[model samples]
Target: MTLRIGVIGTGAIGRDHIRRITNDLTGGEIVAVTDVNAESAKNVVSELHLNAKIYENGHDVIKADDVDAIIVTSWGPTHEEFVLASIAAGKPVFCEKPLATTAEGCKRIVDAEVAHGKQLVQVGFMRRFDKSYRQLKKIFDEGKVGEALVVHCAHRNPTAPGFSGDMAITDSFVHEIDVLRWLLDDDYVSCQVILPRNTRFAENGLQDPHMILLETKKGIRIDTEVFVNCKYGYDIQCQIVGETGIANLPEPQSVLMRSEAKLSTEIYVDWKDRFIDSYDVELQEWIDSTVKGEMNGPSAWDGYVVAVTSDACVEAKHSGGIVAIELPERPAFYDQGNNKVL
Candidate 1:
């Protein structure tokens, strides 16, 4: 049975999802769409030649009879309401990260989902579906790297136009916030942010080259360097220091070119290029699981925890002090033990 999907926010990510659902994947079709920019939505519908109706707003798309499920790719601030509406309508929704712009907003979504008595929301944390990350996770789980001690991560971007002071933590580093928790199967206890010098390329009062220090409940230390004006290429690196051995993410698989007295491999320009396959895998899995009346990826609780942790990190960034992450007890509704190894 083809799941009829309604998509909100026909921006870059939203349009990409519509393309994936309509052209790249199976068991799903986008039947309705709405965006704050109606022209963009119309253009996407026409450009893709999609047979979908343009609704007046996101709520109308959610209420459309033909839309069996919902996908929220709108602005981060608008997520809580659309997701809650989907839950109230008893439809599964795939929400892009932040879940909401704030921790309290995320908690509201969690409360609504719990009151509905089932899991109907999945957050788009696609790194978990990356093949390389999965391989690293498997190695860690198998004790190939016996008892991870510390993790060093780097998230680099070629250029960041709108990145401002706290966005280095809230917007860019948030991915690490979620994936690290999944990798260690542990929750964060405290966070601290360290700022080095800023790059001349940074604009709009954005701080570049920030370091985030996180401590897990299990006493593992993780440090991430978020450099938005790296100026070279988009690079993501993670190295796990363990008791017995060290494991790291393999460099992006590109053909090595030896010419002009240089050895080189291509670097992706953005997340869209770097993790396209991971996004495809994540969406395909979501489709398959939703068809089976379940969800098999990051839950709403995961989104909430990341939001809470991110809030702490933002506070740490501003205050120049270590901030403690205070997370509520995990609810029984989420099946915590179902995390798959590899």
Candidate 2:
């Protein structure tokens, strides 16, 4: 049975998701889509020839009884409402990162999920589905890397997302908070943020770069470098150092040949180019698992952890020092590393 999907937003990533579902993946079809820009939404629907119904707003799309699952790719501020509405309708929802703008808002979603007595929300942290990252996790589990000790992560964007300095932590590097926590299977205990010397390449108002130091509950440490306007490439790389070995993501394309001294393979300048396959795999798995009454991605607990840690990191950034992160005790429901009840 094809899972009926309703997509909200129809912006860059939103429209890409529609294409992925309608053109690339099976077991799912986009039935309806909504965007504040009706012109763009209609153009997207027509271009895809999905015969998808267009709505004036996201709520109309999600509220349609025919939508089995709703994808909340709308503006970040609007995530909480659409997610809760999907829950009220008893339909599964996949919301993008920064689940809510604030910790309390995320907690409300968590409360709703718990009240519903089942998992109905999956947060979009696509790094968890990337093949290279998955390989690193397997290596850690296999003990080839011995006891996992530290993880170094970098998220560099070729350009800023037309936002202010504050959003650098909330909207941009939030993926690091989500995926790193998922990889280590532990909650963050504290976060320390630092601003490096500014880079001139960034637009004057932007911060250009920052650093986040995170310590997990089980004592795993992560140092993250976030440079929004790197003037280099869009890169997401991590190196996990264990007692025995070190595993890191290979630079996406390593085949460098020098012909005219301008050696280059390809530097992904955007998320679409860098994580294209991961995005496809991520959405495909979600559709497949939802069809089977299962989930194959980050849960509400994961979202909560990321939100709490992000909140702490933001505080640390503002206070100019380390801030303690207080995460709720792990529930038994999330103890499994491979999606099984412990």
Best by lDDT: 1
Q: Which ten residues in a row have the lowest lDDT in candidate 2?
A: 333-342
TM-score of 1: 0.98
Q: Which stretches of candidate 1 lie over 4 Å from their true place?
A: 340-342
Best by TM-score: 1
TM per candidate comes to: 0.98, 0.94
Task: Give lDDT tens digits, candidate 1, residues 216-304.
Answer: 98899999999988999889999999999999987779999998999988998888879988999999999988998988799898889
lDDT of 2 by residue, 1-342 (tens): 999999988898899989988888889999999888888889998898987898888888878988899999988898998888888888999998767778888889888887887788888889888887788778777888887789998888888857685777888778888777666666778999888999888784877688889998789889999988887888888998989989887677557777787876877887887788889999999998899887658877777777788888888988998899986665665554254211
State model 2's lDDT.
0.83
lDDT of 2 at 156: 86
The weakest ten consecutive residues by lDDT in model 1 span 333-342
